[model samples]
Target: MSGGVVTRGRERRDQQNGQNSKTIEQKRDEEQVQHAEANSLALTMRSGLEAISKEIRDLKTEMKKDLTTLKEQVTEDVKSEINDLKREMYQQLSANTKTLQAQGSRIAEAEGRIAETETWNMEVKDALCKSLKQQQMLQDKLTDIEGRSRRNNIRIFGIPEDKEGDSAPKYLHQLLTTELSLPPNVNLQIQRAHRALAQKPNINSPPRSMIVHFLEFTVKEMVLKKAWQKKIVVEGRPLIFDHDYATEVVQKRKAYNGIKKLLKEKGIRFQTPLTKMRIPGTTDRSSTDPHKKQHAMPWQRVGERREGTARSAKEKLQEFERITQDSE
Candidate 1:
């Protein structure tokens, strides 16, 4: 019996060992299947990472292109601005140059005109001087001819400088003494040089113009006629003398007014001033003296005063007042 029991225990132990071996084999097979699935998932993750890297590279390239385009556009804009500024500078410089040139031209023209005007003024002065010199010579000849021919000669020469054109007559007087020395029989005397009636400026007193007076007479009839032969010059102008000049001019003046009348009528009216008196006049010819006798004015005879009273205006007033008071 003991033997049999020991055999059964041994059989039981062998069965338990076999079952444990089967269980271990099954567990190993399950582990191998799990590892294969895990490997497949890792492979999928690697592929997704590669796709993301490619997308990032494309984005970086697009950004670079945009930046290059923007830089080029900015450069073009700057170049345009510089060109505009250069154009404006050129225009301004050109305009300024034109303005300066115009101003220079005007200044040159003004200087030229001033030079011309000065030359013209010099010419005018020379012409006027020449004319005056010729006139002076003619006046001298006229004066010399009159002085040389006459011993007791009555002459009229040279209007006053302030009046017409006669100043000192220095040139004429010198010519007479040097160019045409007077004969021993002839006497040259300026009777009086006085102011004329057409008044002008004076140095010493009130303003007065001038008139020429002279003493002249012919030694013989031939000499007298020759002196006044034809040429009478006044103020550098020629004149003709007539015996009836005074009478004819007076009649013409009564008819009309002219420069001739002004020359003849504007001076002292008499050789000697007459006193304010009503006196009788008589001629030297005894036969004709009867008709030449003059009478006192009727108004002067009527208004003549007797031997005057001694009373003055004041005394007369007092006498008049006394008389009035007595009557009252």
Candidate 2:
């Protein structure tokens, strides 16, 4: 009994030991498979990391190259634009300089022309002054000649129109002899007689004046003195007799009308000879006297000045001729 029990116990213990060994071997096999899977996954992750790093490096290199090319292009474009602007500025400056030079030349030319014109204008002014002086001298001479021609003539106013017959000289002689109460034998030698040159007047209008030329100045003076001494009446009308002065002398004498009227009102005795007034006791004298200092009338001074200007003009002309000869 004890030996059989020992044999069963030993068999039971050997069976339990064999089962535990198989279980351990199976666990070892599972651990080896897990280790292999872990190694594969680690390898796959490392490869992916390497690929990403390589791509990033390549992209960086490309970007650097593109930035360098863009910088060079921009620099070239800027340099070209600056060169264009500089060339344009130089062209404009050259054009402006040429325009200024042209204007300067024009201004210089205009100045020269103006100088010449001024010289010409001065010469023309001198010539005009000389011509005017000569014309005035000629006018004075003509006036003097005209006055002398009219010295023996008389003008009669308040005479009826056509009173003088066909022979005017004969009629005027008779009329003057009767009206003036002259001696029958005193022959008033009238050279010619005529009405003033004008249209015939109406019956109501005043008659035209009559002009009579006397043969001698002494006879004319005598008649004028007689007429002034006493009033003369013919038919029914009073008549006036006056010396027939030249037109210029008459105009000059008209300027003295106001002074003459004043003198008459004051009962002062004054005589007008040509343009000069002579008061009997005054220092007034003819302008012809060079030695005496005369109280000259305004008209007389003007006449004397005109005569002096004429003489001065002649002297100036002579002086100009002398200067021209000397220069030549």
The collision pairs in model 2 are none
Which segments of candidate 2 are over 4 A away from where they belong? 1-96, 201-205, 235-237, 279-328
lDDT of 1 by residue, 1-328 (tens): 9998889888888777777777777777777777777777777777777777777777778878887888888989899999999999889989989988998899899889999766544444444444455776775566445444333322333332443235434433432334334464454454544444454545444333232333543223333354356454445644322121132223433443343355347741221101111123522232113365655343222332222221233345478799999999
TM-scores for candidates 1 onward, in order: 0.26, 0.60
lDDT of each candidate versus the true structure: 0.49, 0.80
lDDT of 2 by residue, 175-263 (tens): 77886788999978898899999999999999998999989999999999988888877768899988887887778788878888999
* Root-mean-square deviation per candidate: 29.5, 10.3
Alpha carbon lDDT of residue 297, candidate 2?
Answer: 35
How far residue 24's Cα lies from its native spot in candidate 2, in Å, is 25
Q: Candidate 1 local accuracy as lDDT?
A: 0.49
